[model samples]
Target: MSETVSPPDRAHPGLLGQALALRAAWLGMDRAPAAIAFAASVKGIVLLYVAVFLVFCATRPGPGSMLIVALGLAGCAAMPARRTLVIGLTTLLFIMLRPTRSEDLSDFLRRELDLVGSIDQRILIAGAGIAFLAFGMAALRLQSTFRETAPGRHPVLTMMLVFFAILSVALSGLLPVEFAAEVWLFLAALASGFWCIAYALADQKVKQTTDPLPRAAFFRPFWEGPTLPIGKGAGFLAKFEAKDDTALAVTRLKGLKLIVWGALLAGLDAAARSLLHTEAGLPVLTDAMAAAARGTPLPAALSWASLVVHYLLDILHLAAWGHVVVALIRVAGYGIPRNTVRPLAARSLAEFWNRYYFYFKELLVDFFFYPAFLRWFKKYPRLRVAFATFCAACVGNWLFHFMGRIDILAVNGVLPGLRAFESYLFYCVVLAAGLILSQLRKRRPKPEDGFLRYDVLPRLHVGLFFCLLTIFNEPIDAFTIGERFAFLFSLFGA
Candidate 1:
């Protein structure tokens, strides 16, 4: 079995739940040939990076532009395999700056707006022309290996999409919005590029013909599944249906671990902001928070309201962003289980997460403590599995700072520069404590008194959830949490 999870023929149309709807056969090949998956990922990311950068250079911003181009090209030359290396480099390029001041970069970008001026760009255009000629020949010559044997189609639309995409990203930092034409053109390019890539992935699936992986995911018991010994590898990740259904619970259990952790994360962030007001360059909201933070006077009526609103808003934001990336990854062809938000919708908190961010539940299940439990399960059995699972998850939860929480801290001005890292570390400890305490109190399985029925009631859940979220996490709200939540609820006519 390959790592490809195709859309099942019988996929449920209305499930709307990614985990429920998505099923993949267990891949026979747990490991692909020599980093094949990595290579594909890298290639797409690099091609995407290059495509964007080339367009940026075309704008010819300044002498420094030459340096950015040179480094990017050098990276490409060194990592021609077109795998994780390129994509990681590019994605990290954007991500690594969360705590740093981007004002300078933005100003510099404005200076370098004229990609149309760079001599190097002229050289690149010439090179692209030559490459197009060469690709046409290769298309005709080694058509079998290099080109898909599908019916001849120009895919010019995809090309234009890519062009606009590359241009949009390149110009976004380089120009002022006042230049309406350039901005519009750049956006058009990005939209086109994204569409083309989407088409390309779809085309790959169609052309492969034979289904390499399963149409459904498998759940294996702790003893049954092989130890992946890799990152995020423990979850009920759809590795093409490798094991028995009964042994593996339909989904992983760590889903609740992460969502509760995600919620506790808010408290952690609040503590950081409140406690480190000076280092964070602003006041953090609390009951005692200033009435006039961020130029807005706190409203008395919504003091308690905003706190709840903030938390729910955060949930929606996390869910929305998580799904977007998950979709992009699926469309791009990396069959990472849709482990983000869906798991959080469990009827019961546990079931909700299993349905929501299923991966974390699996992560807590397999990756974190499963290994340790694997050693003793024969002797300890139930106790070992249950105990180790949540413990390992606590440790993983504590480390959440590394993956994401830190960025939120910095962006929200919880901590400035390197301080954000330290602040997040502190918050994670508190969050872990919260998660551990919550886990210690779980009663034996009760019938699923699932999610509040509000979701099915004409989107009342969605509206209320987001309204609360918008109030608390408006990013610019600068209001106390209680106030935000209250303000959001008041907006409802009934």
Candidate 2:
């Protein structure tokens, strides 16, 4: 009987059977925790809101003040804020504007700055150029084509080469002046992001830990956000990438939350603009400046409040967009961190700087601060920190902005651009000084420091400083520094 017994037969499944099995496995996550289920539901709602928000905003007509408002929102979202009320109020305005405006959305959108078309073309071309450069560098290093030509071995040289090539393209006359300036600025923006990779490679080479730049990251800056990138380099971002299915799931869930939050913030931005500027009839900075120039100045209190609203809304917009982009990345399995953190709650200038536009700050730190810190200031720790802070907060910051807006200079003439820079220059100097001092005075708060000293005072100081700084930050290109000062002094009855 034992000899006659036959082994049990097994049958193999076909492709369709395997697919069904996969489907069943994927759908069988019923054991996921209650918290995860709740989170997933919330994320779904958020993403839905985000879609509605973007379509509404982008479909609007013309750039005009809307572009400025968009910029303001971008500033807020890209930076950390302590509160959400302003964000909410601003969002409500946009929600209302979208429906009430009778003009055909497509008509307005089609006429958007012709500059936008050129900008897009330039961005793509520049991106392709950078890709070529990156691959060429990678090839040289990988193939040992030239031992001395490796990017890691000659990081500074590699950067310099790219810089000159970009400069040549910008000045090549192959493109129109406006397009050329945009190309230059686009490259500058990308440079701020790419410098981190160069710095990483350089530092690693110094320590014999060099690795090739990830090819996938070469064009990241082009699509990450509109103007400023939230993350710097592939190497840095690689650290945050999800390593497992669980981590990937968590990151995607987080992305959904950000998208929802950003959509809500967009609503707040629209509301703020409606309440403060549209309905209340507060003149925009440009109008206010014009009025002031004509000797019919805005009321001091209103001027101050207007600036605050403008800056707050701008920040909200940036934050909103940043969340959308970052969430998309996270959902794609790259768990890059948020670009901003509680910026409004920052206890110090340095803290605010670090929290706001985090990756931009990182770019400055990687390329400007660290180099100065490590190489030149070893003997004077305080001076070292101050110097490094200046290099980043002032020099790098100013250069980036100036380059980004170089088109303004070219279009309006260099003298006008320089004049416009006066207010910005003053703002940068003050910002640099404050940040430098903050850096030098940085310390861990002791328990004895108390909530008032450690928690309340520092935050208040940061808030006040940023608020005052916003005055200079407003569209002050048309006005002299003297005019801006007079306007500020008028506000305080000085």
Candidate 3:
């Protein structure tokens, strides 16, 4: 049977309905007296809190103590070109700021600038130029070869091109040994940003609904953090961009609310850390290990409590930071979602993974999980699912972290760095196994199961599992696998 297709004008009538609803809401916000009163009261309260927090918490008071102002200025400077120029500048910044023993930025730059002006820099620049040309040429060929068929395009070609660039930079010998590592680090930072370019290439090749972002909007958001792309692609980001005056106003308001909420969480994290570490005298993992080695071990309960506090504080810190970053982006007219959510309430390993470090999970799932899932294990559904889960949860997770910390690889060499990652390696393996089991055992809840059995118990179980694994999650160099295991055992009177 031939299905009747709707006309393009009526194809997405729902979008029009949504637009009308939004206009109505905006008009209502202005007209509603009760809403106006409530908004005014909330705004006044938030302003008061902001003032108090700024006075006590935000300002540190002293020379060179206005770090917050410096950060605000940096963000402001980048805000103008939140699309591409910022990425270029930031990448250049990373390249120039090679690791140095020099005590000050001025001294370090003076030393590094010589290397920057050397043949190594030229080689690096030349390599980038050639790579860009190659990508452009390849893209053109793909377009011609595929004959406008989008299905033939793949992200792997772009990824392989990036890998080649990294390898060329690292082994080109056009750079000093120390400088080559830094260059590799810079490339790694820019690697994930390639998603934008890849998506753009695919769109151009296939002629998708997603119009490729102009070249200017391509690279900016990728290197904003440690290789974990904050907002995915320009297409995903388009949904959040403020379309009109009302949207801009709403987005800015949302940004303001986030700033306030982030401030509260930050305050809470600070208080909790002070109470746990300063008042209670409980140490972090590294310090605890040192204490144990000295035979001055803390009580098991106190130690466990400190670890729990550390984990919770870490989550709070990420949430606060994510909220602040999302707020800033929204205020600048691009709406990005929060990176962290209510992870503590997650009912399973899979749920926790999704809630915590959402963008990282998204990156792995998009790039690794789906690809592996579709390509392999078609004959065995369960194995395919589990294997694909492992690819994302373990393999992709490790690669992201390892490359993100390329400085360690530079200083210690590849072997030593891998050695130092033993605990992390174990953690990833165990985590993947747990997540796979959790996925396989997942079931729908019955009303008769009650809240305790269905909700509270499951949440507690997942929380306990993650909390236990937190010991091995730290950089293994900071605390060895044996030390982490011993500490874990000590928590249970071993």
Per-prediction TM-score: 0.33, 0.66, 0.70
Candidate 3: where are CA atoms >4 Å away?
1-218, 292-297, 442-447
Deviation from native of the Cα of residue 472 in model 3, angstroms: 1.6
Would you give me the overall lDDT of model 1?
0.35
Q: lDDT per residue, candidate 3, 1-494, as tens digits? A: 99998766645548888899876665565345554354345463244234433532342322222233233324423353343444444333332332111122223223333545445654553454334434534554554466435334564455545665675566546778556644553354344334444545544444443322343243333223333446765556666776654554455455555655777787788888888788977787567655554556678877777778778888898887677656555554566778888998787889899998898788788777988999999999999999999998898777656644444554466678678788888899999999999899848445589989888888888888888888888744677787777788778877
Writing each residue's lDDT as its tens digit, candidate 2 over 409-451 gives 5445556767888888888889999987787774855558999
* Lowest summed lDDT window (length 10), candidate 3: 97-106
Q: lDDT at 57 for candidate 2?
A: 53
* Per-residue error (Å), model 2, residue 349: 1.5
Off by over 4 Å in 2: 1-213, 221-223, 412-416, 442-456, 476-478
lDDT of 3 at 255: 58
lDDT, candidate 1, 1-494, per-residue tens: 66987776885457556544332212211233322333335463454435434433443324443353345345543554341344334322322221111233233223323433443533332333233323222332332243344322333233434443544453345554434323332232222122212222333333532221111011111111111111132121234221332111111111212223334444455554455454643322343234433334445444434454444445554554343333222222234454455433332333443544454556455435654666666676556655564555455544322222222321343334334344333333443443344345455233353333433432344333333333433332244444443443434421
Off by over 4 Å in 1: 1-301, 342-344, 352-367, 376-382, 402-494
Lowest summed lDDT window (length 10), candidate 1: 215-224
Each model's lDDT comes to 0.35, 0.57, 0.60
Task: Report each candidate's C-alpha RMSD, comma-separated, in the order given.
Answer: 20.9, 14.9, 12.9
TM-score of 1: 0.33
Question: Roughly what TM-score does model 2 have, to 2 decimal places?
Answer: 0.66
